[model samples]
Target chain A: MRQMMVGVVALSALMAFPAMAAEGKRVSVKGELIDTWCYFSGVMGRPDAVVGSAHHTCAMWCAAGGIPIGLLGEDGEVYMVLKLPGDDASNGGETFLTMTNDTVEAEGMVYERDGLTYLVVSEVTSNDGIPNRTHEDFGVVPGNVIPDAVVDKVLEEG
Target chain B: MRRLVTLLACAATPVVAQAPLPFDIGGSFSLVDQRGDTRTEDSFGGPSLLFFGYAQCQSICTVALPRMAEAVDLLAERGVEVQPVLVTVDPVRDTPASLRDHAPDIHPRLVALTGSEDALAGARKAFRVESEVIGEDIEGPLYAHGSFVYLLDAEGEVLTLLPPVLGADRMAEIAMGYLEAKP
Candidate 1:
């Protein structure tokens, strides 16, 4: 009876391992905007308290010494439609793109690849009062390129 | 009752608006550039464009540094000597080999540095600059930072911060302005 009971306990412990590993860790982050990479904010999160402003956050990625990236989602997951920086009028804002945003949010696993951090977002939602806007507001101006002269003439005539 | 309510509203209002953080200028700290070279405040011959950054920097560093280097080359072609420094904020990961492989192609005269975190912290404190590292979705975590190509006088006093994206001629002009100024 004693040996049988021990066997049951050992099997239960083995079953719990995968469950424990799946549970991701969450922690608070905050910091100053030191640099920005590829329209992505490289604001240094304070190790002590993970918090900072959006302006600071954006400023970090926009900084001269910062890295830029396209926000990566999970395999086969789709991100919002957006434009990229340096997109020409001919291309209509389609090149150099990613699912990047400004608002700080909670995500799943935070990992680094190719010397840049990739935040695996299980559920990415915005914080603070700012609603999640598209890359258009961030100066990306996604989709349907309207020529400057045509836009001006239409506005003037209208 | 209306006057009492108005008085309460006035009391609830803030006394003053928040001011921006004052960026401090001109103190000195010892640091190592990406080249594994130990540079003090006195390294540059003329006014130096002291830039604090790292090898892992993807966006601004890669783009801006090359632009700045191109501008510097343009200046050099015109017979001007300007020293540029690239200091790594992430010292632990930014090895000298990494800098040599990735950074030197930006410009001929550019200097790279990576040192102890304390040294970097000291330099940041001295410059009144700041930084923080955060978790990312693609990689692990990255340092979110600001861009400034600091125009420092020969004596290491900051004149002004150039914008992250500017033409080489304009950058050369800014550096020239500081070079013309008397310490």
Candidate 2:
């Protein structure tokens, strides 16, 4: 129930984006780099709550598990991110794995098809790492993402 | 309300909006299917769903493969022929013999393919998919690989790519839209 309550804040762009061509449009976008699966599937939490410092660890797990990263644009569009600069593994690259959850300004080719958007980031023009610190509000959206042992250890230390 | 109605109508009918893929993603390659039969991109005689992952992979492949199979089944129910193909990134464990054993569990019609490491690497390169050895568990060597499913036409042209995050229902809906223009 808590998961449902927290996760109801839908990313409107997921369903709102209309059909468009596959032509690559060059644009510089400012947004949070996100784990596409959790954000779309809503298995973690709400769109606003699951991003930033709150969902960073789970984002790593998803990235490492071969889940595609996405750039959630400030306008509420989620661009399914392909390769970023200096890392073109075609799978999830090391660069994207490290940059997940970090809010950044990325310039790239954007393509929209079948009501979905995609991006191939040429470079991250600027990065303000994880400014949307929702952890204070949501406390690890998907509380199980962090192991109880680790949480207990942190609590014991305090 | 009107927009929703129009979108639903477009999806329910044949849509001529077969937009070109944004990237170069497929090519010809000779690989062995689950039946130990030598097959190439031309082998699938109908619209197809293709993925790049090994039979033993426990990562994203687990998520993507089953969803692709389900989409294939949903299309089948609607009398659309869509072959489901998996070209393995782990050629070592996913040989024809092994794929034959496992393909039925995923979907009876699944055509899981594998080949020499070099041959498999070429297939991945053509699709722009990358596979790297991450670590191993008792089950086998795990790999991080491309998890997107490619929707292809009879001639093996990639119509579009499906993100692994999509559910089978949405995947089928998207594929159905593309397919209505075919015949």
Candidate 3:
């Protein structure tokens, strides 16, 4: 009787929190396709991570180099873009290469782990042309241009 | 046996559907502003839209920053004041002077920030933004980082993440929705 009671209590506890119950779902989302690593890492501190038509070559290289793809939804949700089984390798990187910087509608199965979301992309369609802003003239500057005072302060703190 | 199989399948199915799990996205930081003054998370007494990008960025930042400026302007027109902030990912080159030069082109009221490498790294980690130096031997070495704009409440708690796909007008509308809903 005691064992049965414990089992019932455990079952009730599991029923209370439902989020841990399933893998994910099949859904469609409309958004801009992005390279995950560069979008996440380079945008914060690096210029090369910027996403747009100007950076299409770099993005394509990254995608082909095995970096995962991502879709940034209009609602601010980020989905990790993936290729389904039997999908051509060219469909993800090669296709995205041509479609870089454009908004797209994608259908996929969405999953989440460790606070990050992933989408196994089954289909994709372009929604609009690329936005008209590009930074073609922005050139890299030398890294040693900081004033002596700031350098001193940083070294002192270090 | 059939009943047991059904029970097992039901047990394995996840209950919650749309919402992803809670994430660790925002935290406190101390950095220098475009004016070379030190500022903290509490410097802005109201809601702020924060994003990470470098002044030398030739791609997304160019578009994102201008749209951010427009969003700020739109919010102001609606009688909602929202601070727009740009935190540089390239600490080695994006000095206060650089920020000052670049920020005004985006918006007169935009605040640009940079700090020591350690401080910038700490802030990035707090926000879960990824950044790294690439192509050092190339003509124009650049840092790559995340491109999401984060909306934070007065107390510096993250409210939402904005992707680059949202236009200035749409961004303003969403931001207004959040501000209006604030108690």
**Best of the candidates, DockQ:** 2
Q: For model 2, what is the error of residue B40's alpha carbon versus the real structure, in angstroms, after optimal superposition?
A: 0.7
Best by lDDT: 2
TM-score of each: 0.49, 0.85, 0.55
Give stretches of model 3 more than 4 Å off: A1-158, B1-21, B136-140
| Model 3 Cα lDDT, one tens digit per residue, B1-183 | 232244234323433222332234577889999999997766887989998888887656766788888899999999999999999888777899878888888788888989999999878877766665644534355654566677776766665555554557767765665566566
Over B94-152, each residue of candidate 1 has an lDDT whose tens digit, in order, gives: 77777777666766667777778888787776654446674443744466454456666
Candidate 2 iRMSD in angstroms: 14.5
**What CAPRI-style quality would you assign to candidate 1?**
incorrect
Which should have the higher TM-score, number 1 or number 3? 3
Cα displacement (Å) at residue B143, model 3:
1.9
Q: Rank the candidates by lDDT, best first.
A: 2, 3, 1
What DockQ do you compute for every candidate structure? 0.04, 0.17, 0.04
List model 2 lDDT by residue over B80-171, tens digit each.
98999988888888878889899898889899999998888878877778678878899878787778898777767666678898778778
Tens digits of per-residue lDDT for model 2 on A50-125?
A: 7899999989878877899989888777788867888655557678789999999999887655566678888899
Instruction: Tell me the spans in candidate 2 whose CA falls farther than 4 Å from its real position.
Output: A1-22, A153-158, B1-22
lDDT per residue as tens, model 1, A1-158: 01112122222322433232122234222211112232221222321111122223343334312332223222211121111234321101212112223333433344221112323334445433223333223321211234568657976999
Question: Where's the lowest-lDDT run of ten residues in candidate 3 chain A?
Answer: A1-10
Lowest summed lDDT window (length 10), candidate 1 chain A: A88-97
Q: After superposition, how far is residue A13 of candidate 1 from its true place, in Å?
A: 72
Local lDDT at A81 for model 1: 14
Lowest summed lDDT across 10 adjacent residues in model 2 chain B is found at B13-22
